[model samples]
Target: MGRHRNDPRGIAQMVAIGGVIVLFITLVILGGFFLYKSLPSGSDTAAVPEGAAGTTADPQAEEMPTGSLYIRAVGESSEVVVTVPGGDVLADTTLKTDEYLSFTEERTLSVTIGRPSEVEIYVHGERQDVEGEDPGYSFAVQP
Candidate 1:
């Protein structure tokens, strides 16, 4: 007698094939996730703007002058000076290698770095190329 489509052996074989397919799909998805995580994500510090030293305004963060300035000492020990027009100094101190500082300032602000190449600056969530041709670098931001 010929076996029917719903026979016990046929049902078992179909279930096994379905399980194998599911396992294969799961493995493929897991492999893709690992590959994505393994790739280099790059550093946020590398987002500095190209060409001349200046502040690149971020349109998305242009609501007000209330924003934070991030300073990281990359090279040797250096001093970071922040001044606001008609206001007290925001920050004035020496930053050593791997050391960092941040301050929230409003309105017009000025920043001076003793060692241009030794420091990295970010304003209002945007990277500012404070490194200039000279040893020291300074720039003013109005917003």
Candidate 2:
């Protein structure tokens, strides 16, 4: 009969190496998936339109997160104040040229804008009218 070459240590070593290889492959795949997602898909975004318009509900109801609001300052910069319906200020900051502020609250939000004429407002992906305020003024948006 031929000598048998069955070593327990060798079998365990092979299994450990196989596990390491699988881990490495999984890490590589996840890295590539995240990189692809991070890249910008397009530069042609929809424009909000001119003039001070009011906040609009999502017509398609698919562009933004449900029960949340996304407010963006387009074309120019503006000072904004974000508050809940109870008048508690959540944020008061100045938006630079083309900036955005997001609110997670579902209640109505009051946004006071400075330099309203130069700044354009966009809610979610659709354009919003600043309510036709030429100077510093305020408007409301409910999500």
lDDT of each: 0.66, 0.61
Report the number of the highest-TM-score candidate.
1
Q: Name model 1 segments beyond 4 Å from true.
A: 1-66
> Residues 1-143, candidate 1, lDDT per residue (tens digit)?
99999899999999999999999999999999999998867532222223312323232332333246767777877777777788557666666665565555456778788887787777776877766636657788667
Error of 2 at 111 (Å): 1.2
Error of 2 at 128 (Å): 1.1
- TM-score of every model versus the real structure: 0.48, 0.45
Error of 1 at 47 (Å): 24
Runs off by more than 4 Å, candidate 2: 1-68
- The total of clashing pairs for model 1 equals 0
